[model samples]
Target: MALQRVLAVDDEPFNLEIIEEILEDLDFELRTAASGPECLDMLEEFNPQVILLDVSMPKMNGYEVCRAIKSNPDTSHIVVMFVSARGSVEERMEGYSVGAEDYIVKPFGQGELTAKLLKLGHMLLEKDILEQQVEDATTTAFSAMATSSEMGQIVNYIENIANIDDVTTLAKALINCMSNFGLSCNIEFRINDEQFHHATSGMCSPIVLELFEILKSKGRLHEFTSRILVNFDYISVLVLNMPEGDSEKHGRIRDHICFIVSVTEQQLLAILTRNELCQQQQNLNGAIAMISSKFKGLMLLLDNNRKQNEAVFKGLQEQFEQRIPTMGLDEDQELFIYNKVDNAIQKSVAREEALIQVRAAFSEIESDLTALSNKVDEK
Candidate 1:
């Protein structure tokens, strides 16, 4: 478990030789492959716990090779680190998405490569120790709980979590589900931009929480000794004990744990999305209400203006008729002035009609907005 074996795969013979030369002093079981296919072929026989994969190999690139290795149940546990000239963020993310544990750029010094490997070596040793502890600590209860069928538990878990709207409730549901499988575990969930960590017996210890933070980006599934760390998006789960003595049960449990964590992550996302939508709906409702109120005020003001305009037109006609005879104006002059007053009154009537049309349009707009808000509420 001290990182005994390492396989370096590259298209360039010189690059492979350089890797070998750099690690020669570290006493590793070093091997080299000239192509990606050769590297895969060596996996079954050499079975190195770590792979130094070059990104730009011909035929099958390093990303593809890493994906293949991680997808295979037999070799999925092998850690992959990319050794490549492409050091961009996009390239590194691609490497991780395909199950590479770490990324190292080309022309790395001996000290850097060795130091990273040494850290991995420590991790392997810790994993071995954890495995032994799990085997030693496993009880009769766990063996009895391992009936090899987790479908029912999964079904119930999904049912229980489907309608969960709060992170605390969801966290408790997960802890209880794992307990049903006889697992003492710690779980971390990132919900609504908040982080919540829960454990079987109590809150997650400081060290366990730190481990979750460190291991969350390691991959979808990472095992150390007797524990497996499952991660997806904003969810991370650490199963405290795995049945080490029973390989068949262990494999089944590992798969089940992965599936369960994936479902939990999905549920957490659903909760977050649902909350966001609800907030948006509320905002829409508020906007509609405000617009409707403004429209109502405009209609009232228009109604008052229409009544005032009619009163003014009536007073002008009455005043003109009464003053014409008193002023002893010529008949032609009186008739001309009367015609001008009538034309002005007609224009005011037209404006009143336009205001009525404007009021109708405002009512229609308000109705449409109200209906849209109702639709959002239904969902």
Candidate 2:
């Protein structure tokens, strides 16, 4: 197999020699450029996996070179590193601002450069495979005809499907365009739990299907859709997946995936919460029954005690009249019995009010629970 390519750009011969010497033992094909323009020219013929650029160059600095490389679609995906004698944090940040993968100080060891290159090489390989697949699938050789009514219709179709909630509709529209415009690929799609689901039709071989399953298990709300587009010749698309490091640029990628993952997680949490609410409703029902039963027993006991006391009070006058005279009691004793009767009536009234409040609270809890049950069912 051919070795991975590395492009080293520096104005100083000694620095270039040092870089070359550091990688002399490594197993890659090394290419050297003395300036930014020369590096860009070499890129046309030499597709290097990584570009190690010196920051302080004469005509075009490392930042400018990085900017140029990134602006061009052909070299944008290539990994770039800026090397400099001025290793201040500000300089490093500037290098990164221009799309450099890493910033290396001039006095760096061979192991450090080698390690960085290895990591960047793997990432470049993955990006290349993905970009190639997308390019091949999108490329077409049809004639460029003048704009017509059909163009307007196609634009309208794209606009309408662009914002639609249904992924299936959008996927179908995309496939229809491919078919009508003599483009490659057929699309088939569905909606799984409010998110889009899709697969390239006529290319669902075991490997492709397995890829779909892996993505599905990964779940919906993905920042962007993972798609496979086969050509008119039914050739399968191969996209490479690269794992990311903890860098800000990497975070952007993670942020996208996280947004989708959160959507799925939110949906799942809603489902679980609904189930929990249902269980709570069941528990609430049992509690209400117990409260009602206990309150009814208490009310019955209060009523029985009230009736017996009423009977005693009614017969109290005769008993007092007979016993007070026999025991030589006065009218003051009769006054005391009336006072005791008033106190008992006041206490009974307070107990009745408390029972009413308890009943009211039970009704409120029942109403709220019913509302929650409806919400769960709607979900």
- Which candidate number would show the highest TM-score if scored against the true structure? 1
Please provide, for model 1 over 117-186, each residue's C-alpha lDDT reduced to its tens digit, 9 standing for 90 to 100: 9988888899899988888668545655654357788998999899899978998999998988889999
Model 2: per-residue Cα lDDT over 1-379, one tens digit each? 1238889999999999999999999888899999999999999799987899999999898899999999999999778888898888889888888898887887899899888887777777777788787776554211112224335545565455535443344455554544443333423232233333333354445665555444544433233333322211111122223223424433433333333223333333444466577777778667666766776676677667667766765686457556756765567976686577667667766766776776677667666766765665565
Please report the candidate that would top lDDT against the real structure: 1
TM-score of each: 0.60, 0.36
Show how many residue pairs clash in every candidate, following the order shown. 4, 1
TM-score of 1: 0.60
Ten-residue stretch with the least lDDT total in model 1: 140-149
Candidate 2 colliding pairs, count? 1
What lDDT would each prediction earn against the true structure? 0.89, 0.63
